[model samples]
Target chain A: MVSSQSGRRSRRWKAMHDLSPRDPHAGALPYGKLNLRRNPFGELEADDWAALALPAVDLDDVARRLREPGFRVQFVGPSGSGKTTHLLALQARLPEARYARCDSGRPLAKAAILLLDEARGFPRGGGSCALGVHEKIAGCAMTVELGAVPLDRLDLIVRSRVERFRRGDGPVPEVCLSRLGALLERHGGDLRLVFAELYEDIQDAAM
Target chain B: MPRCDLTIEFDQGKRSFAPGDAIRGLIRVRVEADADCKALKLACAWRTHGKGNVDKGLVQETVLYEGTWQAGEDRVYPFSIAVPRGPATYHGHLVNVDWYLGVRADIPWAIDPKAEEEILVSWPEGERSPDLGPAFSAPAARRPINEAHAFVVAKVLLLLGLVGGGGLLWEAYRSLGGKNVSGAVQYGIMGLSLAGVSLGVAYLLARNVLAQRTLGPVRFEVPRQYARRGEQFAASLGFNPVAPADMTKAVLKLKCKEEAVSGGGTNATTHTHPLGEWVLAEEPRRDLAPGMGVSLAGRVLIPADAAATFASSDNRVIWSVEAEIRLAGKPDWKKEVRIAVLP
Candidate 1:
């Protein structure tokens, strides 16, 4: 069982010109005051998958859980608990693998390495190393339980995202330890909701 | 796993560009370890960031290099990109449009090596801006369509009266035409009652008769249709009453929103993000006497940093004013008037 890198924390912000090409603020913010390029936690585009900052779980462990020829690896977690992100990061590493997000009452599609997200009760796809990120599924061969994210874990995740969009060696807006505690408490460890609160905070406070 | 490092640099030092301009750049690559590159691509594009779902467009793209690379090998691919017509770059509270020069090395059985550098597109100040595109008008203005509503109400009433009158004529000529006068009269009254009910329903649906009955004409003025950012624009609103309007207060807001239609066919969704808003006026009052409604005058300054209105084939940033009059015991009066804000 591979463990997440909890001891390592210091990740340096990249340095660039004062007004580097990354500050997309039309003419709003003066140059890059805080080295802010784009909001790291904003909506994801296709290319954005390469920089997901999943510091909490080791992707290699996830890959290990899906190697068997006809295995079913279910990931049971609440909404916004980094299930889809885990699938996406793995798909980035394994380009040929397919990733599908299940909608309201939609059937699962077949793939070599099927990374299914938001699955309904008890995913039914048999064989083909299906890593189902589902809800309310019972014990299985391997179940990666994503519980409420801790403050330190959240900090690492934020840093990985901010690293990709750094404007310069300047500071990056981060969810402080104190603030993270409140956010986690208020949202019941829902990372998506926490990010939304932080997103608004940065937008409101950014120059 | 196979791996490669991708880096991009523009020939020009300044990243700011205007529409129709071309960017000359070089993509430098280094393969740290052995890797089989399926394909390498360089692209110029724009994407929106902020609270809304991301919307993006690839302006230009080309395949740069492909095939295997030995360890410690360095490669350079120089190219030029013709920038697309405007949506330029915008940064607002709920929306931010950005341009980028991205390079990627797609590798099989390995993580894709990718790098992206943001760029600036400056326009709206230079050219008139991009085309408004097709299916364009979303109509930001909320000026009651006063005349159209009036016409609809009058037409509905006239139709009801005409139908009811025909029934009445039959009833009056009952003795001359039919022997069943009582039956004909009952039928006429029933027709009249049905018509009267429909008339009320029509007025309720087509227009706000309650508002008309309580207050006089509601008027708003934006002196100039076109406005430049960082400039002051004068707007005045006047209200008169037919009877004493049981109103509490009136509020006015000026907002800029980004509209982009995403997906297609039946799954198409028009995502509207209200980026920034400013309260131009909010006056509290108890009530207005008959023919004694209030008049308001104010100057609204388009923030120096505000994103000017933008429109492209599939996107638009619209500016409009919304007015809401709160009534003590009646449905509030609301209106939205569109205005043009140039970069």
Candidate 2:
């Protein structure tokens, strides 16, 4: 009887030993190794200002003009061109400014400093408004035409994000940096596309 | 400021056509002041627009008028172009293939003013054009090698080795009979060999009984390539076994998932989320003989709240039915069929 029981135990041990070669972390990221609290590239709330990589545009001049009552300024750029990022950053500096959608039915007459998004949709009216649009609108006190971020700036942005997620022990691999540069060129310096591709590469490497 | 207005109108007052159909349109231009016009051009092209990068193919182009135009010049240019017999129009979540007729007034020292109107192109009923094959091909099924034979062979060899070693040890024990010291040593050796042989046999039997069944190819039939949300559908599965075997489990499942591409450049990320799932069958098991086959049919209800199939440049929502069969002591046989869920 003892021999039979021992044999069963030995068989079970062998089965378990055969299964041990599989990766326990397959399909899941090794978050503990990277030492990150959460994915850094995920959607950011208003307070998550630290992750914002502002472009080299003159934010000071735009902010100064926006502070004045009845002063109209417009930020024009294509989608994913950091128009919203700059707008959000400017909003952080000027708390009194009101952010309003152009199509919203709400009354904007009483707004002291109106921040209108999708400026092309806004009706022509009297008020000091900061507009965000894909194309330049006529009659603005100042227009800042935003374009794609430069490759050098994009590299720094990628490096900073990686550093934020890096565990202190291991140096970031050279392959990752080179891959980021190649991706930047392929995507024409579109920062959003660059970051998304980087996040996927990191996850694949972890796998 | 110089002013120019361009308008495009389809001949039949409709903007839909099929392959080999001729697209006829009129381009009207009205100018308010004398302008150094580079050219008045009409172009027909198909382009994709959505979350993905833009891709365009110019089908044809014709110049309506070139050189200069005077003030109060108003002219109408009519055009007729035969649509290609392929490249059917498609509308998806992140990608759209659309044909357009555009008129551009190339003006010197200013932005070129242009007007464009979209037209739909489709294949005729029950027709499959060769050009649309790559764009509309069905997803390929997954196939992986079966390694059960290798596993069984290894276990059988180990069992044989244990039995042969045990027999050799027993012969040695019998050679040294009746001496107290030698007997004790021989008895211990015999007992160890017996234990090893018992363990090997038990393992071999358990593996043979639990994991050695061979499975055949799994095939599934779904109602249509696309289903509307909240629509009820039927799906069936048929499979053949290489030999008669006992099936421990069989099931079919319907699942919807969303895949999105986030980030840009070399650092793009693709993320997936399971939107909904339903089990069509469970606990289906049977014992069969060699060459025996099984077929199962079931009705599938798409949840009313399920997200409709959507595909953009870097994002997609996909729905599929999975057929899984598990045999006693063998790897599971699994197959999947993809279906699009429309809103």
Best by lDDT: 1
The digit string of per-residue lDDT tens for model 1 on A47-68 reads 5655664634577776765666
Provide fnat values for all models in the order shown. 0.43, 0.00
In the range B102-139, model 1's lDDT, one tens digit per residue, is 88888888878998877888774534544332223434
**lDDT (CA) per prediction:** 0.67, 0.60
Counting clashing residue pairs in each candidate, in order, gives: 1, 21
- Identify the CAPRI category of the predicted complex in candidate 1: incorrect
Q: Write the per-residue lDDT of candidate 2 for residues B290-329, one digit (tens) a residue.
A: 6777777777777765655544445455788887777776
Interface RMSD of candidate 1, in Å, is 6.1
Q: After superposition, how far is residue B112 of candidate 2 from its true place, in Å?
A: 1.3
lDDT of 2 by residue, A112-148 (tens): 6677766574445565677878888888888878787
Provide the lDDT at A188 for model 2: 80
